[model samples]
Target: MSATRRQILSGAGASVAGIAFTGALSELFAGSASAASGVRAPGDRPPRGGYGPLVPDPRGLLDLPAGFRYKVLSRQGDPLRSGEGPVPSNHDGMGAFPGHRGRVHLVRNHENKTTGKLGVPTVPGLTYDPAAKGGCTVLELDGRNHVLGERVAVAGTAVNCAGGPTPWNTWLTCEETEDKAGTNGYAKDHGFVFEVDGADPRRTGAVPLTALGRFQHEAVAVDPRSGIVYETEDAFDRPFGLFYRFLPRKPLGGTGSLRAGGALEAMRVPGVPDLSAVRETGTRFEGVEWVPVPDPLAAETPIRFQDFGPKGITHAQKLEGCYWGGRAVYFVSSFARTGDGSAATHFGQVWKYEPHRRRLTLVVVFGPSTDIRLPGESPDNICLAPTGGLMVSEDGGGAQHVFGVSERGEVYPVARGRQNIGTPEEPEWGEFAGVTFSPDRSTMYVNCYTPGTTFAVTGPWHR
Candidate 1:
């Protein structure tokens, strides 16, 4: 979802092409009449008393809110152990542990989006690579970006996308392939989450969370209170896809095994019974509710809440990048179809899910009408900054950047990607895919999936 697209430039519901100047303004400022009738638009930004870039060139260096610095913790091909092997490439998703004395455990998801060459053959014990088999890596890092200890070879997983950190200090590595085992040496069953622990490698209890129905798994977020895990899908078939939640069979106490079966459910905008009915208008949709998990676990979930659909119905669009931020769950769609009938839809949006209040609200939408210089920038993995905002990863190529979006609707780039990430001829690190802060929120750990490198960024990010 890039801002340069003319479709998203039109604003809320109307197309910006060849319209009256005043009409264009209204379209951008106009609130959705069908959903939350009188609610204010989420695109408003407050005047900043003080704000500026903290680093000289935020590209390689980490951009903190304020008073922060970063260090190169580790790079790909770095030696982990005596006989293990060099660090693999395409380090996608990562996690950091605070209690481990600054030791960070990361599950690097290899893209294989390009040519395979994953880095398994390099390791002696590791022997798997259909489209590339380099799953998760547990690396221990200090505050100064020093590698304390590391263990590689997650064993039997490929195309590992983004994963979520569990309440029990373990990383849940998810295989993003829709194909099951047998097709390739990847996960015997695709679309599953594997539990990996840093302290105990010999413990050997890693199991695939089959209960959490197999699909194009993107990311998972677990609720510490009930151990209920929220999930996202990356499917592109038919009426788009859905956002799901997995409730573990037992309570999440002390965090042991995540294999226990539980209830799995998908999200529904309630009143919008037929998703097909929603016209392909790129208006920012809001006021959605959760639906049941469905018996077959393949769409068809019963509606639970209905208020924002039907008459003025609109699709939730591509719901990707979700995380537990503040007291609520925050989710964002990659891009919505432009009402202007263009192949590109640059209006990317973010929403907040409040379980206690049982209400869903649109927090922000970016496009030609908004503050983001580039609309339609697909925001990948997201996390809430300690200063209380969202740290988003931009996977889009041209405007590739890591954004620190303030709660007041201010969007600023914290880092940028060098044109070409990695290649023998032109190797350049680019973009932070996953960003997480220490419990204290004083330090931030960022990773460049393009170059497959991770850095420890320490600074005063909180204004």
Candidate 2:
């Protein structure tokens, strides 16, 4: 559903104001008991209906495609180094760091915009914060799930949500907060993208892509060739949400650091004034297109794209997860609500934006269908599977389930029983968040934030 001012206001009570976010950081913690929330009792595991035999459900561990299985690469409180503390709560976005001896450097975003649960310091130069919630956590891990090292307190901000991997192997962590520096001290730099080195988590730097402007940031996508970074926001109120692109000032001579700033531009629908009217209308298979990034650095300039009014803006609502795959960029809306903030017939949707042709395709409208029984449930984070399918984490209810759908539109269950992570009251669990696959496509990782837990899933899937 489109998060209204009422929603934001309701959460305002939890919003932490100035007080040096770092100071909020405190003792390190470990994953809560009960494995993962929303998970089913052991024996009821769905058989390998599509992928393979009915292997034992990982339970608290990562769930994967039927034929596939996984192992726990890391847990919430696991020590990355000898004396380092556990990772923080609310792990979000991450990316793979490249090198001959490549490893996955995960820059996890904490959705905790208020509470402070930062970890302990292992070395002399470590920065310890008792109030480091809502920032990003850096963890280095090998494919075998071996912990190489970790760095907490990366960017001292809150609600840092879904970010993307840049061409340079850096993870761009986006803050979902609106620009309210007047109150949220970090809001000035909070709504912009912060770059963190994937190789070294200890090395934390906060540089707002001023060119990227400020808004309720969601996710970021990069075009390796042009060095242009595309971004999505969760704004559902004013003028609707926008799709943006950051035109860097300089190209990396050899995949340099994100320290090289660039121009940020918001996208608007061409010829459409208010996209609010066309929220959920089904697609006509018409060729989709987006308006140009006018100011290139201004957040206000309109960058429009074609949408449906009969159904309301399909891309409307609190836009969340995003990924760059198959020569195109894909994004999903958290929920489709009316201007009055009422739930649409469907809970969520997935859309595709072809950068080369500058077009959009409303690929899927999720609801109560023959296959997916969950209607009015919102689909959260998504990742592309090597087997040419899309992996989605369902955040609708506390009992979360993961699913896979091939390019041909065939959908099936990959993993089940991921619920129970969050208590009914806390809001944020339900087994759907941070769904990703290993580079080799042999492993899968899932994280449920409310009562934080990380699962490593492995199985057989021909990528």
Candidate 3:
């Protein structure tokens, strides 16, 4: 459930105003929906809950409501005009932007880590590591399923994780692996953030923004008003993961260039220690402070174990998706329950950070799940619907569905995904990721990581 208005800001669970945050679109939607019907295609199961409960997909690919429809825009093994062999698998985070005329530009992440597939190998001189199999692909599309063009936006990165959309209109693609230089073959360090131009993919040379520090970066959110960048770590080993903020020496410049010479710092709560240990759903921590990382590069040590660890920055479990909304940086922690090795009680927690107040508060959270058909367990990628509150892409086991959490703490289903049979003996059930809407808000786009597929959805989104 949601916290009181005051609780969302202050650490106290009190309500000051009955209001909805700018980023949460729950207010515009209805609480419960009349179960809808579906027509199953060959080898597909009946539909479950979604926008209108879900209608079975006749194509056996995706399920939607009565009026809604979906089209597979891009798929794995699809030939690209760009030299990047074929569309890579393990598609993760993504962002969409306005392009020429009525076209929209999309920069999608391919999270594959092995060198088996042809990663982002299209660019001539821009290849970072020819042997690495993780990078991003750029696509230009129109209102329908037509893919105007596609190409490699960047390459040579490992575990290219979820990044944020810069105010300067570039996608900051972060590498999730932490392989040292020359260790995993012959190449430079792995974990770094690279900026790719969405307006024109070919122009972006896949330059790494080293000033943001290197670690297991899960996601990033840039505060538009302050030009400060907030990052999340997905570390699982010793020293756990910590939240970070990178202050550019100079404010954000043109072309999405993250200026070097900036200081990276970890987040901490003054007196309320251990933000992760909080057991309640709306637990809040006010007056959050920033501790310098001293060596953000982490060449000698990971970001969590650095001096910043002893300084009292709160440690979290697998911090994932991050985004800017309602004057706060909304972030996600997959699971932190007692079973998750954390003292916390929730299976997942969503946090909100106020840049002006330098405060961090827990916003949305979920307990363990029993049914696989519902929005099970882990909540990964995040999206802000102007009229639908917060839509979360569930990365949980069993049924992979996109669930919505309202500002008032109410949770509901947005969509559900069905497994597409490809290779036998392998679980084709993929996470619904890289969720974003068209600039016009008429179409919604999402991806299934394996049996790699990208779908464009459109209908009465107001529901």
Best by lDDT: 3
Better of 2 and 3 by lDDT: 3
In model 3, the worst 10-residue window by lDDT is: 31-40
Candidate 3 wrongly placed segments (more than 4 Å):
1-50, 271-273, 337-340, 368-376, 406-410, 421-428
Give a tens-digit lDDT track for model 2, residues 329-406: 667676655644533434566666666776665555565332223312476777666454456666653334566654
Q: Model 2 — which ten-residue stretch has the worst lDDT?
A: 23-32
Better candidate number, 1 or 3, judged by TM-score: 3
Give the candidates in order of TM-score, highest first.
3, 1, 2
Candidate 3: tens digits of C-alpha lDDT, residues 402-461: 655454534455556766543565434577888988876677889888668888888866
Candidate 1's C-alpha runs over 4 A off are 1-51, 54-68, 112-115, 120-132, 184-187, 201-205, 273-317, 338-346, 372-376, 422-429
- Comparison by TM-score, 2 against 3, better one: 3
Please report how far candidate 2 places residue 286 from its true position, in Å. Answer: 8.2
Better of 1 and 3 by lDDT: 3
Clash totals for all candidate models: 19, 47, 8
Global CA lDDT of candidate 1, please? 0.54
Error of 1 at 364 (Å): 1.8
- C-alpha RMSD for every candidate: 8.9, 11.9, 9.1
